[model samples]
Target: MVEIAAWLRARQAEGTLRELVDLDHLGHGRVRLADTEGPALLDFSSNDYLALSEHPALIAAATEALQRYGTGAGAARLMSGNFPVHQELERAVAALKGQEAALLFGSGYSANVGIIAALMGRDDVIFTDRLNHASIYDGCRLAGAGIARFRHNDLNHLEELLASQPVKGTRLIVVESVYSMDGDRAPLHELVALKERYGCLLMVDEAHATGVFGANGGGVIEEAGVASGVDLAMGTFGKALGSYGAYVAASRRMIDFLVNRARSFIFSTALPPAVAAASLAAVQLIQQEPGLRQELHQRVALFKGYLRQAGFAGDLGPSQIIPLRLGSSATAVAAAERLRAHGLFVPAVRPPTVPEGTARLRLSITRHLGEAELAAAAAALVACCLR
Candidate 1:
């Protein structure tokens, strides 16, 4: 215990320790932190891209479910915890993603780690993008597979690694559709082609892209017209869909396999009925309401244009996520403070979340904010950078 205390103290001294701060979510892209009382700021750090978390339909669904099914899932899914809402949500998700079946998980992290661990083993070889979510890396490590990381979004490097290495028992390639920190998309088409050439399984995590892309919010896989090419497509309902839980959309056989083999899914209690109901509502709304997706894209364009006009140089790619690079942890924190002072709430992402010396403010655009709020946020960010 003393050694643990000393290590924690050392981390705090190095400015690497993290502590959670309470925040009051006032609707429409506004939040007030516990330290402050009166004014709520325009938040650019949220993953609620469509602002559906507080939608009336989702709220109503959750309320109805809570009244009907009580609070907790008493046991794991393999036991007596599986409810009607759970199956309904899975069916809806599978249809949305154009998959034959879908399996729900407690969270995106659980889905990633569970899927990888269930499929790969010590003899298998896993190739992952260097910038994939930490959950994917954790899964690889836990599986005890031979892991190789390719340069971020570099298909050439991936192919080189594949060519240099001999055929292993099972080769799995993992990547994210849109990187959470950088907001850049992976080359899914190229990756699919490579997977075909090498006869390896491909997995694409669409956590950041789902509910924001495609005609029906099926995500990048559907948008690219390569849904059939990829083997496993994983996504989360907590981001653009503005709900909780995660899922892996795959063929019927794959879903069945995961139901039996994935330890995380097998051991964890099922999501509460209310959460499943709310997520299902969110998914239905995302399909029915194309206007929300359109508005989000327009806002992203407007915000990016404003930043460019203000002399911002970083590219945010085609996604709604934008990063304001600040170089050092101290500078990023200071910049966040400046933004907060101007009634803007942006998080400063430091080392481990981002690469060393590339600490940045990750700004996520949502449809809740209109042009005026976006202008203010852009100006505040520009001022912080200039200062």
Candidate 2:
């Protein structure tokens, strides 16, 4: 116990230990809903890129589902809670992705963990992006596969790594369609070509791209025209769909194997029927409501254009996620504080979530922010940065 406390203290001293902040019951989008420290703020820290979290259509669906199915799933999926709504959503997801089958998970984290750990083993080699999400990294570790990293978005490095490594076993390449932190894109076609050349299985995490990328918001894979070639695709409903839970789109054989073997799926309580129902409604919206996706694309373009015009140069990837590099952790936190003071609520992303010396402000744009709100945010950020 003494050694553990000392280690924690050392970590803090080294600026490597994380400190959590109480967000104080905030709403989604660019507004902090509630707080004890000061006034309510306009939120820009949300991952709800489509602002569907509070959409009337989704809310209506959820409310109706609640009346029909109640709150909890009551048991694990393999047990009593294999709700019909779950099967409906899975089928909808599969059709939307043009896949043979889809399997649902309680969260994106679990889907990645269960899929990777179940599919790969000590006899496999996993080639992951250097900036892949923690969940993917954790999954690879848990799978006990030999791991190697290609530079972020660098297909050349990935190919070189694949060719140079003398490691044996099945090769798996993992990447995020749109990286969560950097708001950059992976070179999907080039990576897919590499996989074909090397005979490797490719997995894509569409957590941040779902509902904002593809024609039907199938995510980066669809946008890149490689949806058919992807071996496994992971997505979440909590972001653009304005609902909760996640699913994997893959072959029927893979789904069956996961249903029977993935410990995370079998051991955990199934997603509540209400959540599945709401997600089904959300998917229907994605299919039928072209206006929402259009509006979201416009929002992303407007924000990125504003950032570029402001000379706030950064990666500014082709997706909604944006990051403003502030260099030091203290500076990033201070910038968020300044934004909050100006009635904005952007979160400061620090170490552990990001690597050292790369702390910055993560700006998540949504369809909810009108022109006035965006202009105001731009002005506030300009003021803060200029100061």
Candidate 3:
């Protein structure tokens, strides 16, 4: 206990200790501190890119499923937890991702860990980005695979690492389409070509790109027209879809392989029927109402424009997730607090969420914010973040 206290004190002294801040959701992309009487803050911390979390259709689907199927999947998927809704949702996801089949997992963490571990072993080698999600690192560890981490989005470095590997060994390359903290996109087309050249399997994590990029909200792979070249397209409904679960779209054979060998999927209880239903409804809404994506991009542009107009010179990147790089953890935390005082709730991102010396505020834009809210948030951010 004393050791743990010392560790926590060390974190606190370094300005990296985290605390939970409870907020009351007031809807329309606004929230307020649960214990405070301050005005609602413009929410820029959510990943609900299309603002579909509160959509009526998703609500109706979840409500119906709950009333009919109960509140939980009472057993593991291999036992009695599997439902038609789960399978139906997988089908929809597979079709949307332009794949032959799909498999569902309880959460994105379990999905990534299980999928990667199931696909590789001690004899296999996995190449991933240095900035890949932590779950991927855990997965690689579980697999006991030889791991090579390339610099972020550096194709040349990736190829150099790939060329040094054994020709007969199983090789897999995994990366995220859009980086969560930096908001930069991976070059999927070039990545596909490199994988093909080296006879390696490619897996693209589209957790941030799904429901926001492709015409049918497929993901960056779809937009890049390289779906056929990639082996696994992994995504989560918890973010853009505003639901709780994750999936991998791949060949029928690969899905079957994971079904048999993926311990996380085989042993864990299936997702609640209502959760699957909600995801399905959200997917349908994304396809039917394309304007939501358009409006979101426009809002991003508008907010970025306001910042640039205010003489801010930070790189906001190409996606909805914007990082205002404030040099140190203390600086980033202070900027976030200042923004909070101005009615904006932006979290300060720090190591190991980001690398040391690269702390920033990770601002995620969603369609829920109106033009006026975007303008106000931008002005607040500039005033609080800039010198």
Candidate 4:
């Protein structure tokens, strides 16, 4: 206990200690932090891109499911936890991604970790993007696979690494459709071609792209017209769909293999039937309403324009997740505090979420904010940074 206390003190001294900040209320793109007794601030730190968490349809479905199936799944999925709503949600996800089958996990982390560890082993080699989510890296390590990292979004570098495979057995390449931190997109078309040429299996993590890209929210692979080429695709409903849990959409055989082999899925209790029902309803809503995507993009564009007009320069990519680099963890935290003072809730993203000296403010855009609200938030951000 003393050693743990010392370790925590060391972390605090280095400005790396983290604490949980409760939100008294979270809705309508604002949150009332428990520590603050003031009104809710405009939230730019959320992952609710489509703002469907409070949507009537999702709420209704969850309510109905709760009344019918109760709250918990009671057992592991392989035992007695697999509910009809679970299978129904999987089918909806599979259909959305244009895959033959899909399997659910507790969250995106479990899905990535379980799938990678299940599919690859000591004899296999996995190539991943350097800027891929930490979950992906954890999965690679857990699998005991020889891992190689390519420069972020650099297909040429990826090819060079692929050509120089030192140990080769069941080569698999992993990348995200839209990188969460940087908000940039992967070159899916080029990656698909390269994977085919190199005879490597490809996995695309669409956690940030699902319900935010493609005509039917099928993500970047579908937008690139290479959905058929990618071998495995993983996504989370907790983000844009504004629900909980994750899924891996793949061929029927691959899904079946995971069902039998993935320890995370087999060992963990299944998602509550209410969550499954809510996620299914959210997916259905996303498919039915394409206008939500359009509106979200428009707000993003407007926010970016505001930032550019204010002479704040950083890589604001084409996607809704924007990162404003602040160079150091201390500076990023200070900036976040300043934003909070201005009634904005954009949190500072520090290492190991980002590399040292590359700390940032990860701003996520959602459709709930109107044009005026976006403009005001952008102006506040610019002012906070300038100060």
Candidate 2 positional error at 312, Å? 2.7
* Local accuracy of candidate 2 as per-residue lDDT tens digits, 87-190: 99999998877688999999999999999999899988999999999989999999998998888888888889899877578899999988999988888898
Q: Distance from true position, residue 92, model 3, in Å?
A: 0.4
Q: What lDDT score goes with residue 341 in model 3?
A: 88
Best by TM-score: 3
lDDT of 4 at 357: 86
TM-scores of the models, in the order given: 0.97, 0.94, 0.98, 0.97
| Residue 323 displacement in candidate 2 (angstroms) | 0.7
lDDT of each: 0.90, 0.84, 0.92, 0.90
Alpha carbon deviation, residue 340, candidate 4 (Å):
0.5
Model 3's alpha-carbon lDDT is 0.92
lDDT of 1 by residue, 1-387 (tens): 479989889867765577786899889899998776758988898999999998999999999999998998889999999999999999998898888999999999999999999999988899999998999999999999999899998888999999887786899999999999999899889999999999999999999999999999999998998989989999998999888999999999999999999999999999999999999999899899988899999999999998878777767578999887878888888888888889988898888888899988889999888998898788778877754
RMSD of each candidate?
1.3, 2.0, 1.1, 1.5
In candidate 4, what residue range of length 10 has the lowest lDDT sum? 10-19
Q: Which candidate leads in lDDT?
A: 3
